[model samples]
Target: MGAGDDAGKSFVTSGFTGTGGASAQPPSPSPPVAPGKVEGPLKSITPTEISKRHILSKIKRGTPSDVKNTVILPHVDAEADLAAIKNNQGKWLGGNKYEVNGRIWGLEGSGAIYPVRGDGLVEMNKLQYEALKGLITHEGDRDAMAKDKRFSRYKFHTTDEDWNVAQGVYDQR
Candidate 1:
C-alpha cells in the first residue's frame, strides 16, 4: 500500500513501538474495581434527613414550664393574622408590643399572634423577609390555605420566624 493508504488507517499496535505505534490507539478501559469487604456486620442507621425548605431552622425547643415545646407553627402571614386580631376575627393574646425597625410587632401568649424580632422569635434577613412577603401574598397559597387541611393550622408560606414566634407564645404560656 502507499504511504497515504495508512493516513486514514490506524497503525495502532500494542506496546511502545515509536511513531504510529500501539500507543496511538486509545488505552482500553480498566475494569471497575470491586468494593472492599465491609468490616463487621452492617449497623442499622436511622436517617435524619429533613427538607431545608420546609422546616424552620429557628424553631424554639424549650417551654416556660420546663418542658419540651413542640407546638410551634410556621409563619404564613403575620399581617393577615394581625389584621384578623384587629378585626376581631381571632382573639389576640396580647402582651407586650414592640416597635422593631419602625414596625410594630409582638408575640402573644398561646401563640395568638406571631412576634417579631424578639427572644425565641425567628430573625429574618432582608432576603428572607422579602421571600416570605411574596409567598404570603401569593393567591394560590391563600386558596390552598383555605381549602387544604395542612394549611388549616399552618399557612402554606411559613417561615422560621413564624415557627419561632409560635414557640415563643407557647413558652409564654
Candidate 2:
C-alpha cells in the first residue's frame, strides 16, 4: 500500500509478538483468588466508618502511657483475662471487682472501669462493650480526637468478633 493509504489504517497489536491485526485479541485471564472471597468493586464506606477504622487501627496492644487515670490495667495474662471475663470465673476482688492473671477487672456499672487494653481487646459485659464501641463509632476520628482537648487518651480494646458485630450493628443503624 502507498504511504498515504496507510494513514487511515488502524492497526491493533496482539500479545508480546507486536503483530498487527484488524482487531485486538481477548485479554488474558486473571489469577485465581482465595476461596469465599470476591474481587471486584468495593462496597461504599462512610466517613464515619473510615474514621472508626483508622482510630481502631491506630490502637496498639497493651496499656497506653498515661495509665494512671484509666481503668485498663497493665496486661498480666491477656488470654486468661479475656477468658475470665468471658466465663465470669475470676476470683472476686471486692467492690464489684474480679481478678484473673494478676489483672483486676471491674463489673459493668462500677464507675469508669473499662477493662480493656489499648488495642481494643476488651473484657466487659455486652452493655459496656456496646457503649465502648459507640464511643469509637462516635469520636474515632484522628482529627477529632486531636482537636478535642478533653478527649480521653485511653485506647480501649475490643475483640475481633465484638468489633465486627458492633460494626454490623452500626451499619444497620
Candidate 3:
C-alpha cells in the first residue's frame, strides 16, 4: 500500500477509547452478605466442631496400645479434674472475698482444691479458673494473650498432670 493509501485506513484498538467508542462499565456492587451468611467455595466452621474433629481424628489414628493405656487414662483423669473445677464453681475459695499468697482461693465447695500458681499452672478456686477462662476463651482475651509470652500456654496444661501428659505426647510425636 502506498503512504497516502495508509492515511485513509483507520486503526482499531481492543479496548475503550475517548473517541466515543463503547467503554467497559464498572461491575455492579455485590449485595452485602447477611450476618451469618457465607459465600464462595469455603465453608465456615465453629471452633468446637473443629476441636471435636481433631480429637476424633487422633483416636482414629490408632495409637500403640501401650501409649493409649498409659497416656489416655491420665489425660482423661486430668480432664475430669478440670471438669470438676469448672462445674463446682462454689468450691472455689475466692468469691470476690478471699486472697491468699497473692492468689484468689475458692473456700466454700467440696472438691480437691487445685491451686493456681504464679506460673499459671492451675487455678486455686472457681473464680480464678473463670477469670483465666475469660482471658483465653473470648476473642478479646485471645488477642491480648497473643501479645504476651507469659500467656502463651495459659489455656493449655492447666494441671501438672495434663501438662505432663501433653509433653509426653508431644515428645513421642
Candidate 4:
C-alpha cells in the first residue's frame, strides 16, 4: 500500500531475516573438498609429550657414538673413609664414663661413644650431646636411650661435669 509496507514485507521474505515467512529459502550447500595434509592435530600438546618428541627427534638424527663432546667428574676413594669409621666404631676416651647395658665407656674427642650393647656405637657432635643432656641420665637405660630422640641413635650416661665439658666444646665451635 506504501513504500514502508513494501520494505517490511521484503524483509520478512528474505532468508537473512529470521521472521517465519513462506518465501524464505534455505542457504545453498558448499562444494565438498578433501581434507588437507597436516603434520599433526590442531590441539595443544603437553610438556611431557613435547619433551618426548624432541628426544625422539634427537635420537633419530644420531646415536651416542656421534656425540662430539662429554663431561666426567673425578673419582674419589670412599672405601678408606668407610674403613676408618668402621675401625673407630666402639672406641671412646677415659675422662667421663657411661655404663650402657653393663660395660663402661668414656667420652672421647672423636665424636663417638660405644654403648653397653658392644655391637654398635653412637656418633654425635658436642652440640648434640648438650641438647640431649636433659633427656639422658647417668644410668643409660633402654627406655631413656629410646626416648632421647636425638638425630644420632647413640646414647650414653655421663656425669653433669662431662655434660658441661661437652657444652663448652660446642660453645668453642
Instruction: Give the number of the best model, judged by lDDT.
Output: 2
Model 4 spans with C-alpha error above 4 angstroms: 1-147, 151-156
* TM-score rank order: 2, 1, 3, 4
Score every model by TM-score.
0.17, 0.25, 0.16, 0.15
On the 0 to 100 scale, the lDDT of residue 171 in model 1 is: 28
Give the runs in model 3 whose Cα sits over 4 Å from its true position: 1-97, 116-120, 123-165, 168-173
User: How does residue 129 of candidate 2 score in lDDT?
Assistant: 34
The TM-score leader among the candidates is: 2
Q: Which segments of candidate 2 are over 4 A away from where they belong?
A: 1-68, 71-79, 110-113, 116-173
Candidate 1 to truth, TM: 0.17
C-alpha RMSD for every candidate:
30.5, 26.4, 30.6, 40.4
- Considering lDDT, where higher is better, how would the candidates rank from best to worst? 2, 1, 3, 4
What is the TM-score (0 to 1) of candidate 3?
0.16
lDDT of 1 by residue, 56-99 (tens): 33322111111111211233223333443333333222334433
When summed lDDT is taken over every stretch of 10 residues in candidate 3, the lowest stretch is 45-54
lDDT of 4 by residue, 69-111 (tens): 1100011111222222233322222334333222233333443
Q: Which prediction has more favorable TM-score, 2 or 3? A: 2
Q: Worst lDDT window (10 residues) for model 4?
A: 67-76
Per-residue error at 83 for model 4, in Å?
22
Question: What is the number of backbone collisions in each predicted candidate, taken in the order shown?
Answer: 2, 4, 11, 0
